[model samples]
Target: MKQLTIVGAGWAGLAAAVAATQAGWHVQLFEASNIAGGRARSLQQSFAGKPLDNGQHVLIGAYSNTLALMRTVGLKPDELLKRIPLDLRFADGQGLSLPNWPLPLNMLAGLSRAQGWNLKDKASLMQAAWGWHRARFECDLTWTVEQLCNASRLSPRVMTQLIEPLCLSALNTPLNHASAKVFLRVLHDALLGGLGSSDLLVPRVDLGELLPNVCVEWLRTRGADIHLGTRVSATQVSALQHAASADSAVLLACPPWEAARLAADIAPKWALSCAELTHKAIATVYLHCKDVGFNGLARPMMALHSHAQAPAQFVFDKGALSEQHGLLAAVVSACTTERDDVTELVHEQACKQLGLVNVEVVQTVVEKRATLACIPMLDRPEPFVAQGLWACGDFICGPYPSTLEGAVRSGQQVVTQISQVTHR
Candidate 1:
């Protein structure tokens, strides 16, 4: 068996390590950060003597590949995550909530019972949905989500109350610039993919506990070398020579910017393309409010009515989701506001929307380049950059958005291609 070198211990790198080790290869995993999970890791805070995630992340059943990878590593999804039927409640149960039923029907049932929507509004929603399904979610590469909605004649009520929020949450880009084709793909997979595709899987544990931390234990058991806080310099191709070998392969699973830096000397064109990718930021604001009543909006998560003063489009009740109490994670997706400004804005947003009077400022996290600005006709570099030197990350060329599933799927893909080549 040959050695497999994996750079970065993110979800993608972890999955690749697991797959390579299972295929009878010795694995060496390196991470620049001392902590395991990259962006999705938990911030170490002993609130109630337990863990808290940096931000709230939601997974759907459509993430089948990610779920399968978790199970392969002896992790139980049922125990780690809380599965809930598709629901989007806000301001006292005034939003979409799907009952337990098969898809399309579940979607219809939810539309039928959607609150704050008139009969005519519901009819227009149904008609637009049918049109999308009939067209198989296909659209021109240059079309924006806003344009698609307009062409379909989707009512403004539905756009404001549902589509717009969902779009921002998923694509992390503004509607006018977001890609319509990608939006339709997300809708198809989550809403019509399978029985539980639309179901939200909120992690009952911290993000690292759910995947990366557990992965570390599994990799150790399988005899893989783990290196943390070790930065692999990529100023020149010669810098990567220590890890590269005739019998060994190197996998660059780092983010776009870092990967581009490393690949600059190895694969210049690919690196330049990755370096040019436009990115957007995501900020998660934590507000600690004790004794604040749910006021009929008791759902674990809910959508919010956003504005200039209140930029957060969604709020996660960490107390209800996990053991954390009085913790609210308000997410401002695709945010460009300064950190201080966003936090202050979120405080006002919570009070304005949730009616929470008194809340302590816990902490604020802003990932400046949370994801690529998934705009229309975005270009991504190829994953197979060079022989024995391949790339894998959520930022790679893919049909899906930047997500855990995308990361894991990219890892799995690299492993498969490597296996075929080595075996041949």
Candidate 2:
């Protein structure tokens, strides 16, 4: 039997393990941390009298690969997630909410009925949408999202209320630096790719329960060697390579920086490129407002107007999604400031924007390197790091920022590559 040494038990690694095991390979999964979810995992600490996510992550219907991976692990997407229509409902009552209808019509209705937008703004937005649809939402690879928006002549209100939030959330980089092609690909897949593709998927359970924990059980049941809290070193890599038969392989499904370090001797140029790739930060500040009488946002998630003092782009009521009542998670994408400052700023922003006072800052998680700084024309290494040693992660997933879906897709792809190798 062919054996596969899969390093890093993150979602990507877990996905790869599951797929490989199902394909008749003996898998040995290794993780540096005991936790499985990597960036998407939940912590053990009790925040605001309840368990909170490490960060607030929102999935869209366009995350087909992630959803499929979940299903493959025996969890249904619709059952586990609080699915809702595509919308940017704001705290101050100025946003766009798409109807639960089909593509172009839903988008048209959303654009036309967007609150606080002038007639000219609506017309300009409609025209831009029409053009993008006709053009299949493709854009020049070298252009920034800001450049594309300007070229499309999008309304300032639309840009601020709708486009900016979407760009920041999806790309984890500001529109000025984010790739227009990547942004358009995401937008096209969500808005134009048939019914429910634009729907928001808020996790009803913890991030770990969504896939990682379930994946561990699945891997264990299949008799795959699971090594948690174990770090593989240079010696082990060489040993594994020497110990394995000619048909065996290694899959390094780690983060880009870690991958760069591990593959330094194996693939120096690829490692350098991976190491040089810049990253963006994401901060999720959880607040407990148990006394707030207001019924959360207009929807489950709300976009908040933010300035330098108020860094939160969006706020979610955890109570609305899960059993965590009065718990709100404010997300600041591409965050660069300190966690304490972000927490305070988000608290202030929430009080001012939502009129919710006495909000207790439960926990503030600042992922300094949350995602790759998805700039225009970013170059990434391919999945094949070497002959038998392959690599897969969010960074290797082309055309996507560091996202759960991207990670899952790359994981699945890595298994496919391995299957081909085994067959050959």
Candidate 3:
């Protein structure tokens, strides 16, 4: 029987284990953290009598691979997540909000009915969109998102309320620094992929319950070994490598830093490549109002007016989405501020913008290295590090940016590579 040992039980690692196990490979999964979701895990800390997540994440209907993985573990995506139309409205409803209609119609309807946008602003956006569609969403390698916006002649209003927020949320990098190629790819997949590809999928459950916990259970039933709260040392991995048969392989599904540390001796070039990649931080500030039934926003999620002081770009109403009544989470992507400042500023922003003055900060979760700083023409490491060593993560060489779907695709790609090698 073929044997595969995977390090790190994050989304990437968990997806690899599931794929390998289904492919009839004996799998062993290890995670350094007690929980399996890594950066997206649920925290033990309570806010408004509800569990908090490390970060607030939103998946799209275009995340086909991730949705398929959820079903593979016997979980329904529709049940675990609340599907809503693409709504990028602010507290005052001054942005684009797509109807639940089909592709082109929904986009057109939303664009036409966009609040606070003049005819010129809407026309400018339409022109830019048509240009991108004509070019097949392909852009120059050296171009940043800001450059793309300039070339497309997008208006300042569209840039501030729409493009900037989308770019920041998707890439977790600033507009001037984010890769235009990656940003265009994301736009293509969401806008042109399918009928409901652009729909927002908000998790009704915590991050762990959404996928990782159930995946672990599914793997356990299939005889796959899972080790949580334990790190796989280089010496132990080397010992396993010596004792294993020819059909056995080692897959590093850990974060880039840990993967670099493990593969440093075996593949110094790959390690150096991993080490050179920079990362960005994401901060989620949880807030709760005194009155549980008094909803502040018009929708479950509202886009914020971000500036120097107000760092949060988007805020999600946990009360409406997950039954965490009175709970709200403001998300600050590519956040560079300190924790204390972020919490205070977000609280003030919510009060000033959303009209929730009685809300108090429940918890502030800051992931220092939330995602790879997806810059223009960044060189990412390949999966095949050595003869029998492999690595998989969102940071792996892929078309997508550092996202859950990217991580899942990378994980599945490693399994496919392994299968191809074994068949040969």
Candidate 4:
């Protein structure tokens, strides 16, 4: 079996390790943090009184690669994730729900049911969908999301209820700055892929318990070496004349910045590509409340009012854990300014927006640089870096936005490349 070293313990690295091991390769996985899940890890705090995730993460039924990886680790989808139809609730007490419907039509119905959308807004949305379909068929990459949203004349209701949240969640960039091509790809897969495919799957447990920890156990059972808290500083490749060996095959599945630094000497081209990849930061603030006025809210997850005083982007109620402790969490995405005052502002917002009066603020966990900002139209690194070194991450693949699905899909692509090269 070929000896392969996989760097980083994020979703991409873990998925690559699993695939390579299953394909009869000797895999050694390394992680910089003591934990394995990277941004998706969970922790136990005094205030929450239970384990809490750095932020809330969700998956769609259409995410086949992520679902497949879960199966590989002996995890049942129904048990690990709470799967339900697409339900979105706005801050203005308006909501929209999409039942399990067939492709294209499913998205159409969902948009039509959206409250507060005027006739002109509906027409603009239809025009945007038509344009997206046309662009996908023609493979046109020239237009950006800013241009499309403008040309379509989308209403504020459609923009906030549909576009803004989706863009920030997927791309980690605002709509005006995100890539239109990649956004279209996401729509094509989930919205146009047919019924139940667009179902939203939220983790009922902490992120670490949900996937990464399970993955670590599964890999150990397969006899793969899993090394936590091991960081790879650099990678050196043997001269071409020396010929690649079993140990030559190394998979560098890290963030774009780290990957670029590691591959600079070994693969200059890949290093250059990595340097071209841009990133943005996401901030998530977790709050513990003693009492919540609303019950369950509309859905497990709800987008916050961006124009509010505190201006939280999303909020999740952990009241389900009242059987043990009283806790609630909220998230703020694309936080460009006011890093110092974000926690205080979010705390105030939770009280005013959620109507949680007399709630004491116990714990606040802030992930300043939660995820790399995936902008539209920015060039990303390719899968194959060198004869043995490969790159895999959400930022390396096609324009599907930076998401858990994209990360897993990128890992599978690297595995395929490694398999073909080794077999040849």
Give candidate 1's error at residue 400 in angstroms: 0.7
> Which of the two, 3 or 4, has more TM-score?
3
Give one digit per residue, the lDDT tens place, for model 3 in 1-424: 8999999998999999999999999998999899898777888987556568999999998999999999999999999999988999998989999987876788789998899999889999989998999999998999999999999999999999999999999999999999999999999999987878999999989998999999999999999989999988977766665555559889999889998888887788998999988999999998888855686557889999999799999999898888888889899999999999989999999899987657878889999999999999899999998877889999999999999999999999999998898778
Name the runs in model 2 displaced over 4 angstroms.
Answer: 48-50, 242-245, 292-298
- lDDT for every model? 0.84, 0.85, 0.91, 0.73
Per-prediction TM-score: 0.96, 0.97, 0.98, 0.90
The Cα error of candidate 2 at residue 35, in Å, is 1.3
Question: Best-fitting candidate, measured by lDDT?
Answer: 3
Enumerate residue pairs that collide in model 4.
178-376, 179-376, 280-373
Predicted structure 2: lDDT = 0.85
Tell me the lDDT of model 2 at 252.
Answer: 88
Q: What TM-score does model 1 achieve against the real structure? A: 0.96
RMSD per candidate (Å) reads: 1.8, 1.4, 1.3, 2.9
Give lDDT: candidate 4, residue 65: 86
